[model samples]
Target: MTRYKMEEVLPLLEERVRRYTHNESTSVTYEKARQLMESLLYCLEEGENGNGMDIMAGEGDVKTAFTLGLARKKEKIKLAEELFEKIRKDFHSYHNHGYEETVMKGMPAFFLRYDIEFDGKNHLLTLDYPLFLEIEELTGIDLIYAYLKAARIEQDFLKHFPTLSVEEILRGFNGKYEEAYFNISEIVLYKALGCIMVKRPAGGLFMTEEDIMMLSKQLQERSKEELESKLQDALLSLDKELHLQSEVSEYFMTGLPKIVSNFLYYKKIKKVFLLFPKRKQKMKLQQKFQDGRVMEDEALRILIEKMQACESLEDRLYMVKENVRSLRDLKEILKECFWGDEFIQVFSLLSQEEVMVLKKEMKGRIAFGKGCIYKYLIKI
Candidate 1:
């Protein structure tokens, strides 16, 4: 798929080698040329992802493309530095070595000492902290970008609750969790899903021996597709509380399938799934909320939580209007809104006639097919 030929590439690379060596008399080994070529390709690929230039489609000459790519690599390095700062500013760590070292030590050193022009392919850090999901195929700046994106998403989700609650979950997950390698998002997210499997609130993060039995029985009864849907629902339900942007929601959806397949085997919640939220450390129940409010009804609770987080009434409607692209989305969100303040806060902007229309539709739905989500939505 390369637009430029090997013959076309060689002269430019030779010039680069001459410049790199600082003299024409300096020797260029065959292995040295190969490594430089790799660095060349890394820079060229960086053209689009790092800067939005399409070098592969003959936008410019190969030499021009390489120059543009070097600029893009420098820009990407600067960006990663900025992102690390924002993430660590209000950040709550789960107090683990791998996570701390990668963010505080590993990434800082890379920013200061990275040689972008000569060694674009050099990964300056080991990136030891495991992600909830990862793109293993990527290298160089591309991999660093993806890793930071995942870390940002995890931080957004984890910050909703108190730090000690999360610490409690990690400790329950393992007393020596700090010493071991663990994905913070992996533990928090799966524990939330496990709460769903046992008919507990994903927020509470608790499960007993009987609850484990119930979860096992439910797994037996559900098909692969059904289980996957439920897991996705757990995340979406959390999204209701968090009101994550569309792209952030898409990020989670893209990574879910691979992890779901691993969970399908389900032999005792991955050897020791029982290490759930002990909920014993009663410092402050970090219920997911903005103001001092909590709701028990799942659909109403999460939807209202999202709507309430909005600063003004206009933004609240816009958040829902912009994101809900299908009838399925509309029905799912509306059906979950209860017949109280939870519903009122979300529809505060709706006209009286529009409210009447919704009232009729909901009445018909309640009469015809009353789903579990509609249980909290009493007859109007």
Candidate 2:
């Protein structure tokens, strides 16, 4: 016999049932259908052998019970079909709106397909055991009971696989499986919303430019602290209502990236300030650029010239370094006007090639010392 306990097997069964019933067409008689589904779910929850048959009955008797249970389930399904048809007819005019469409069409079909794919596959395969365990704990049911019960019939199979090893389980059986299912459905919903927002009239999901501008202005008027407070309150409300984590890191790492990328375009920050450096050490080279010791006129001109020539933020930073290296080489001739440490610090952040370019520019500037600084810098 497999060492796998009833607690271990229960969650798989519950998840299967959850998926199966997710988008099930609930009727005007949904209460009746829900009860029937619950009873089936309850059987899985209480354990298939909850009637004390596992202990009291022989192996042959257990098989008989299993066979009978399956028969009884089929009859219940037939009754459910009848009731579903009635409900469908009654609610014939009821269109599946945003929420209903997601639950009914997306989740239900996905579950049915999942169960079918999983039926003959080995039970031990799992993508993430922890996530599966979490789902099991939440639902309070076994997910693999049906397959396990079937596996029990073959003594050799049971002997060979006495226990369901977490590693042996298919990864698809875990909650990650459900996450993928939900993610796909969410993508579809987002696309639909996008269509409404872009193609539909202002009265529909889309609003006029004036309305958008007004909303933007209103939001801008709010103090940063007030906005942050409101955002926190909104997240807390969502956490309570949805029973999910509301942390920024979790949101950014998981579903948020996909959602945000779909709707908004973001600019990359070229210059990054290390707010939290691991170590703080002052370099000796920084002393040279301190004050009015070096001529600011030529240095300023070189910096501005390079900045203007570069098309992008990255290019501009590159030019800063090129100017620095050239100045470093002419250290002998321009000892009185040696490049300062402040300039070096800024240059260090740039690429090596940019440093080379700066070196060349500095050499030219020093050689032609009489050039108009403001005009040359502005032209660059």
Q: What is the TM-score of each candidate against the true structure?
A: 0.67, 0.20
**Candidate 2 runs further than 4 Å off:** 1-52, 55-63, 90-380
Give the Cα lDDT of each candidate: 0.63, 0.32
Candidate 2 per-residue lDDT over residues 1-380, each given as its tens digit: 32235565445444444555574643324554344444444433233444533633333332344344444444443443344334333221112132234323433343344321113122222312121011232221133332122212221111211011111121112323223322222222222232222332211112223433444344345454554443344334433433443332244234444433333221122111111011111221233332214335677566665455544432443343334433443232223232222222233343444445445565446443443322222212
Each model's Cα RMSD: 13.6, 23.4
- Count of clashes in candidate 1: 0
Worst 10 residues of 1 by lDDT: 283-292
Q: Candidate 2, residue 55: CA error in Å?
A: 5.5
- Candidate 2 lDDT at 106 equals 31
RMSD of 2: 23.4
